[model samples]
Target: MSGAQRETTEYAVPAGVLGLKGPVEKPAPGTLPLRGDLAHIALAGSHLAAHYVIPHVRTVGTEGAGLRLAPRADGEIFATLPAGSRFELLDVAGEWVWGCPGPQGPTGWCRASDLASAES
Candidate 1:
């Protein structure tokens, strides 16, 4: 033991219990490209998720695209993306790709085939 001792601090509650003091307001389901298990990398601090993913930039095909509430074709269409519109790709399942036009956006599902890599 040295003459200079380290100061120790303790918390009454367990580490896991330490978080925001009050209720947190979360964005609506279709309003953000965030799900219970995954979120956009840009939302890492603002939201909670088991994993955060960096978006892949993609552009709407010449025919344009419709952003739907669900992956299925019959799902409600909330937004329409014009041809060549830039999209931030988050998740993909079958024919649908889930993402937003930008970090702060009205996120939804669009046909994967309707989007082409921006690089191309």
Candidate 2:
């Protein structure tokens, strides 16, 4: 404790509250005390303006994964993932990404955090 300033972020009920449809994140890294059967997703560490989609990656059968255009609803459309588009997962909150494959390939970016420990 040498006078080093530290900042902290808080996770709201939407993040911790169970029965939520979105992905559930952990309070601390490597800790999974609370969780359900929510699909994990990968994010670009920091919010990206135009996250390009990698070719050959599957999506909603469109073509081109762009940045989050407008404000989205809680369970509304977050972003548009193109078909045959693949996006890299930056600092994921988990280890395993999970979700159903879209008409193209994978639906969207999901955290593989917990899926890594699954036996299958």
Candidate 3:
């Protein structure tokens, strides 16, 4: 077989933090899988995180608020940021929404400019 046929695609981290432990969820509607780096922001009263989407963990933002962050792997709640939490936008869709990873095993949709890095 040709090298192309034998070769497989290496699933890069979906635009977010790293070393996080969670489950992987289905991408949003009309959205496709992204490679490396996502985007997020912090709530009105919350703290930010270092990385974006964690590897193998799922995240989900709150409902209606347009915020979600799920882990890529399945496990206990390794970490949490609670509502009004802070996050960085590793990926942005248009100028409205951002796809980010949250605490262990929790991925969902979120606002575009609602998250911020802990450094910021």
For every model shown, what is its TM-score relative to the native structure? Answer: 0.77, 0.20, 0.27
For each predicted model, how many residue pairs clash, with residues at least 3 apart or on different chains? 0, 17, 67
Q: Top lDDT: which candidate number?
A: 1
lDDT by residue (tens digit), candidate 3, 1-120:
344332222223333334445545534432332333432222101222443342332223342234333322232333344445444334445544333343221344444433432332
Q: What is the lDDT of residue 65 in candidate 3?
A: 35
lDDT of 2 by residue, 50-115 (tens): 332222222333334332212122223334444454443322334323233322223333433212
Tens digits of per-residue lDDT, candidate 1, 10-100, equal: 2123324434455558888778778888987666555677987778888889988899888997898888999988888899899899998
* Top-TM-score candidate index: 1
lDDT of each: 0.78, 0.30, 0.35
Model 2: CA > 4 A from native: 1-74, 95-120
Where does model 3 exceed 4 Å of error?
1-64, 68-83, 101-105, 116-120
10 residues in a row with least lDDT, candidate 2: 30-39
Ten contiguous residues minimizing lDDT sum, candidate 1: 7-16
lDDT of 3 at 23: 46
